[model samples]
Target chain A: MTIGIVGAGALGLYYGALLQRAGHEVRFLLRRDFDAITRNGLRVTSPNGDFHLARVLGFRETHHMGQVDLVLVGLKTFANHHLPELVAPLLGPETRILTLQNGLGNEELLAANFDAARVLGGIAFLCSNRGEPGVVHHLDQGRIRLGEFTGGLSAYADSLAATFRQAGIPCEAVADLPKARWEKLVWNIPFNGLCALTGLTTDRLLALPATRDQVRAIMEEVITAANAQELSAPITTEFAARMITLTTAMGAYRPSMMIDRAEGRPLELEAIYALPLARAAEHGVAMTRVAMLHALLEAGEA
Target chain B: MTIGIVGAGALGLYYGALLQRAGHEVRFLLRRDFDAITRNGLRVTSPNGDFHLARVLGFRETHHMGQVDLVLVGLKTFANHHLPELVAPLLGPETRILTLQNGLGNEELLAANFDAARVLGGIAFLCSNRGEPGVVHHLDQGRIRLGEFTGGLSAYADSLAATFRQAGIPCEAVADLPKARWEKLVWNIPFNGLCALTGLTTDRLLALPATRDQVRAIMEEVITAANAQELSAPITTEFAARMITLTTAMGAYRPSMMIDRAEGRPLELEAIYALPLARAAEHGVAMTRVAMLHALLEAGEA
Candidate 1:
């Protein structure tokens, strides 16, 4: 299937590179690395094995990329304003928009601008970063859980998941999208916010008994809010412990928000914190810690 | 009345200077400002009126400062471990131990070491900072409410208030020390922690809508916790708004915790956050935001 990648940062570059290597035509709407990638092609360094693509389709403008079967969005949520214009030119009527962005509201944003029926949301448990120019570093997990924005399982999402699997990603289609999203938040809400606020990594945050307890408390808060959202299954309090255990192995992992804060970039607070908080409040659960965390993060922004 | 000023930072220096200027014998147990104060006396810069006390009584060791009528403990709560040793030599049998430090557990710490009945906790609303060793900058608000640790008004506490008033400090004696402390915390728990964590001043913190709302929420949480402790009367919710308005007039004021965090000094988390949280929990109320704030502050500490 032909694919177009928008907001091509590390996720777009790495995943796009993988698809291209698997014999699919992949095009990237590039910004920062456009020139270098156009001149030098794309280089990917991965634990799976390092490979360099000598001939790559890298575009400075999305309009130049024309239409494709699928459009993958990897834009930072803070830059969501640019999504409509950037993703517009890459859409074919059959194109399914899949946003693998962190936090909530990505699919809704895409669905509102494009076709609500065609937008799919996916949670990528991927650890990757852009190195220099034209180089993408894939450090760890590359699994994708695809689901329909309107809820429930769909054949197209399943096929897309299979397509991701064919490109060497551990991909699966989830029946309950909100549950998957909230389950992901069971980890993101605590680790991302705390890490960004304190400049501590996952392991170090867990290493200190104080913050470690905070991490646990925040996780509990998130799960309580998540369970209130009427998901297919209640995210048990036990899920928090599982997330903590999973993150313990990611030793000193600096979350993306931490890097954003240190580099003076605006945090993705709106999508990651505010929206989730509002949604949870709709379900009659208030997350005080998350709100305080969001406020602290927002107040510190320039 | 002879008074021994222990932990003579800004609070100690300014109040000690005032008491001495009022013709009370004031001896300061000094550290950072020992040399300058001893060599050139003490300089107080204040909106109330600027004054310089020449030939001030300064001591390098507490032993040199003989027993006095009152022992004013103005040390940072983080430095409370040294209070017993520091105040030991300066104690007279009838000397009232009055601590004007921020946060909870301070009065208890002193009461345990010295005479329990003679221990008093005073909430100083003074805004002062130590400058250039011997200088104390008293910016605004020097009102203090003195109360006994064992609770309720006392004849001795009433007299201390009158003495402080004679020294030109706005002072009052309170019937409920715990209630007064918690009311002070209704402001401190939010402003101090938020300002210190974000490196923003009180005005800057309230300038943002998000943080301002957070300030209100935290104040409510504190008040809720405060009310559960069986205060003489519940702190009305309107108190949070009044505190906000009062803070607004003080434009760009930096709480002491913010300054301490900026200077890489340890925060008074144990007294300000942990102790209040634990105390509140004993009454079956929990403060998630305060705990999270405490954990974030603690984890970031070296």
Candidate 2:
């Protein structure tokens, strides 16, 4: 299968490398890593095993990448302004677009702009970061729970999930997309917002009793909002504890937003915070902690 | 009456200089400005007028200053650990220890150590900072609302208010000290915490729509808790707007906590956040944003 990777940051580069190495023709739309990747090929250093892909297809423009079977978007939502133009030429009539961006509204944006039927949203539970130019570091967790933007499981979605599984990414095709997005937000809203806001990793945040209590409270707020959305399953209060336990096992892991802020980049606050806050307000649920965190993040932005 | 000033940072210095200029014998137990004040006297640069005390009384040790009728405390709450020793030498039979400190619990601590009837707590609305050695820059707002820790406006409290008014400081004697403290907290918890956390001053915080909304929300939460404590009057929601408007007029004013953070010193989180949060919890009110802000402040501690 021929695939076009848009917004080739850490996740794009890492996953694209894996897919390409698994015998799929994966073309990456590169920015900072363009020259390094095109010249030295893609290098992925992972806990699973280190692999170097020498015959890499890296592009600076979507027109150059042409059409492909699938278009995987990994753009920071802050940079979503460039999406419509970037993904325009990399489309065929039956081209499926999978967006693994964090938070809400990514799929809707893609669906509004391109083919709604071809749009699928993914929640990637992957811990990774970009190294020197061409290099990508996969620290841990690369499972994806994705579904159609319009909701439910389709054969095409199943086939896409199978493709990811073949590429060594544990993939699941879910019956509900918004539910999966909100579930992902249960973790993202607290850890990512907090770690970015406070410059503390997951472990350090949880180590301090005050912050640990805060994380739980914020998670419960998220759950309250999520459950109000009337999803297929209510994300139980127990889920907050499970998340805390899972995060404890991840050690002192920095969320991607934290790394982004460290590198002096704008946070993806619109999709991750503002949209979800709006949804909560629509459901007559006031996510006070989340809104406060969102405001602080915005106020701190340079 | 002879006055002994404890914790002579900014407020102590400014008010001490004013009292000394007004023909009162004001002895300041100084730290950073001890030598400069003792040798070169005290300089106060203020909007009301500029003034200098040529024959300023300064002491390095609290014991040297001895006991006086009044012991005005202007210490940062973070430095409250030094209170017992620093204040012990400056107490008389009826010292009337007025703590012009930020947040809650100052009166409690002082009352526990000294005579409970002699303890007074003042909610200072001053915006000022320490300058070069003996100099203090009085920016704006020197009005103080003070009362007895045991509740009600005592004769001592009224005399203290009259003394401050005579010394060119706006002063008011209130009946409910806790309510006054909590009312001050309605402003402090949001502005001080937000400014300290985001490095944004009052004007900048209110200029942004999201943060302005957050400030209102936090103030409302504080008001909810304050009302639950059975105050003489409920703080209306309109008071949040009034506070915001008042702060807006102050123009990019950095709260004391913000300055403390900027100077690489510890914040007065216990007085400003923790104690208030505890009281709110005890009253069965959840100050969610306030708690979250408190946690972020704690998590971001250097």
The prediction achieving the highest DockQ against the true structure is 2
| Number of the top-ranking candidate, with TM-score as the measure | 2
User: What Cα-based lDDT does every candidate model obtain?
Assistant: 0.89, 0.90
TM-score of each: 0.95, 0.97
Local distance difference test, candidate 2: 0.90
Candidate 1 lDDT, tens digit per residue, B1-302?
99999889888898999999999999998888888988999999998878898898888889988999899999898888888999898877788899999989998888888779989999998888988988999998888999999888899999899999999988999999999999999999998888888888998888899889988988999999999997899999999899999999999999999898899899988889999999989999988787888888888785
* Model 2 / residue A174 / CA error / Å: 1.7
Per-residue accuracy of model 1 over A38-142 as CA lDDT, tens digit each: 899999999999999988898888888989999999999999999999999888878889999988899989988888998899898888888999999998888
Candidate with best lDDT: 2
Q: After superposition, how far is residue B253 of candidate 2 from its true place, in Å?
A: 0.5
DockQ score of the complex predicted as candidate 2: 0.76
